[model samples]
Structure formats: C-alpha cells, structure tokens
Target: MMVAVDSTEKSCLSADGEDFFYFGYGSNLLRERLQIMNPSAVLVSVGCLKGYKLAFGLFKGQENHWGGGVATIFPSPEDDVWGIIWHLKAADRQSLDEQESVKHGIYSPIEVKVEQEDAGEVMCLTYQMNCFNYSLTSPLYKEVMCTGAKQNGLPAEYIKKLNAIRTNNYNEITPFTMQVRDILQHLQINTSE
Candidate 1:
C-alpha cells in the first residue's frame, strides 16, 4: 500500500504540453529511473485497483525472458490493488510503455480516476496486467515484482511484505534497480502499505 508523493511545484500541470497522468503499478514506480528519463514528471497519488490478482500468465512459453509476474486485471470486488500515479509528458510516457513492454500482451491501457494532492479528481491512463503474457516459472519473478514495489520509494515494512512472497524468483532483477532502492532508502522516502 505505497502512497505516491509529489516533489514538484504546487500546480499539477504537464510542462511538455502532452502531459498525462500514468498509473504506475510496477516498474514505473521507480522515481530515479523516471526522473532521469522525464525530469518534468511528478508523483501525484496512489490507490488500489480492486478485483485483480497479481500473477504470471503472460509469458508461459518464453523461458529466455525473466519469469516476471504481472498484475492481472480481473473482476474482483473485494481484492484491492496498490500502486502509484505519475504525471509525465506523452514522449516520456512512451518511454515508460516501451520499458514495460506494454504491447507484449503483458499490459493494456485503461482509463482511471486518480486523486491529486491539490486538484483532487483527475483522469489518467492506467494499465492492467495482461494475463496473456505472464510466465509463472521464471526465476526472476519475485525480484522483478519487488523491484517495482520498491521503486516508488515504498517503506521497508511494505517491501518486506513483498519479499515475504517466494512463489517465484527474479534472478534477473537489474543491478540498477538495486542501486535505486538503496539510494531511496537512504533518502527515507516511504512507499509502503
């Protein structure tokens, strides 16, 4: 249950003109990476998407790729999905989509309403996990999930919650992510449940 924190000016406007709100449930939560790519991007808020379960169902055949688990969007009235909301330009958003491989049957763009610190209600682009591209047996699964969970500066307690799950492994968790986590921890940014 990590909460999105804003570190920019008071006004919630996209300077690049094509600025849009992106719901980052996983990898896109990493601020260091995002800031490097899009300096104008700002974290807005966070909330749970109910009804979907996190699982690996998209890449059942690709063994060479990381065995990463994706957040599957399903009809769940009781389950709550946790994530962050980021505002970025259209071009930077494209970079995010490319990094996440959103078109690989792993993710699908959907419309969502996000809460902002000052503006309140706002429409944004949220992606649901593409169950079609999930891989259940990949070795880098857990680490990859953790990487995303921790990327938003989630607290250690929440990160521990994510680490508690060992259904899969993420041996391919990049060194860059590890470094980002370390730096975020040092900065004391909390993205926890």
Candidate 2:
C-alpha cells in the first residue's frame, strides 16, 4: 500500500564503482547508525520488500550479548517487510560490507525489489541471516529497532509489530547496549517509542 514520496538523490555506488542501493529494516533503520558507518549513505525512501517477513536470529559462533538474534528476512508471500532504502557511493561498499559483517559470512546481501512509498519498485540489496543465532532479541536491541522505526516514521501498525517482538528479558545496560544509546542520542530519537 506504499505510495510515492518526493524523490531525492537515488544513487549508490557499489564496490565496482557502480551505483546500487541498500534496503535497511533492522538497526540500520536509524539513519545516524548508517551515517556513522558510511558517511556517503543517503536516505532514498521508506519502503517495503514484498514476499518476505522479518525475523531475528543469531549468527553462528558470534560470542557474547551480540550473539543474540539480529534482523533478517524470510520468504513469505503473504508478508511485506518494511524498511528504508539507502543510496551510497560505490566506494563505500567495502566499509559497509565490513560493518555488516559480510566478511564474516554472518549475513549475505541479496537483491530484492523494494516498493517505495512514492517511487514504485526498485531493486536494492538487503541482508539476510546466513548463519544461525539464538532466535532471541535482547531488550536493548529491541529498543533500537522500535526507536528506529518510530524515528523514521514507519507505519504505526508495523511499529507495533516491532514493539511486540518478545525479548530475552535482560535489561541491564552494557557497553554493547550503549551503542544503541549512542545512536538514539545522536539521532535524538525517543526511547519511548
């Protein structure tokens, strides 16, 4: 049901100096987080990936609190994954690849057709869980996803779905959780979301 919004620069340079796009549905929904990692990244639009459902799972062998499940897409004809489209300089590919842990094989980038609110359909790369995780999300991690969704103005129904995701119940703040706090602070996003 997404319709078009006003357009912005829609260019993303890949590793081979070719422009491409990235669809972010997880923590990357926080523009600040992606900006911090890839300065050239720009918001293309809020969009949805059809035929897929969002799920969280752990990356096999990753240790500690981060070992908790991260966001991923699973094929489901009845589902549409809401997310943001990002355009980046082709040269920024390596940095994004590293930041995304693509080097570690924890996630794999796959091409998908994301329907922008106002822009129709466009093919963009989105990461999917390639390794197994604990299948649980931490409280702080859930906060990150919910806050990002609210900050970006994603649909209220979808935001509620994000909020309803059950967590592992650990709420103690840790150095790792601080990363979410930092992004929230940087973007001035309300945790109340």
Per lDDT, the best of the predicted structures is: 2
lDDT of each: 0.55, 0.76
| RMSD of every prediction | 6.8, 4.3
Among all windows of 10 consecutive residues in model 1, the one with the lowest summed lDDT is 6-15
Collision count of model 2 = 12
Off by over 4 Å in 1: 1-17, 35-39, 63-65, 103-105, 115-121, 131-161, 170-193
TM-score per prediction, in order, is 0.61, 0.84
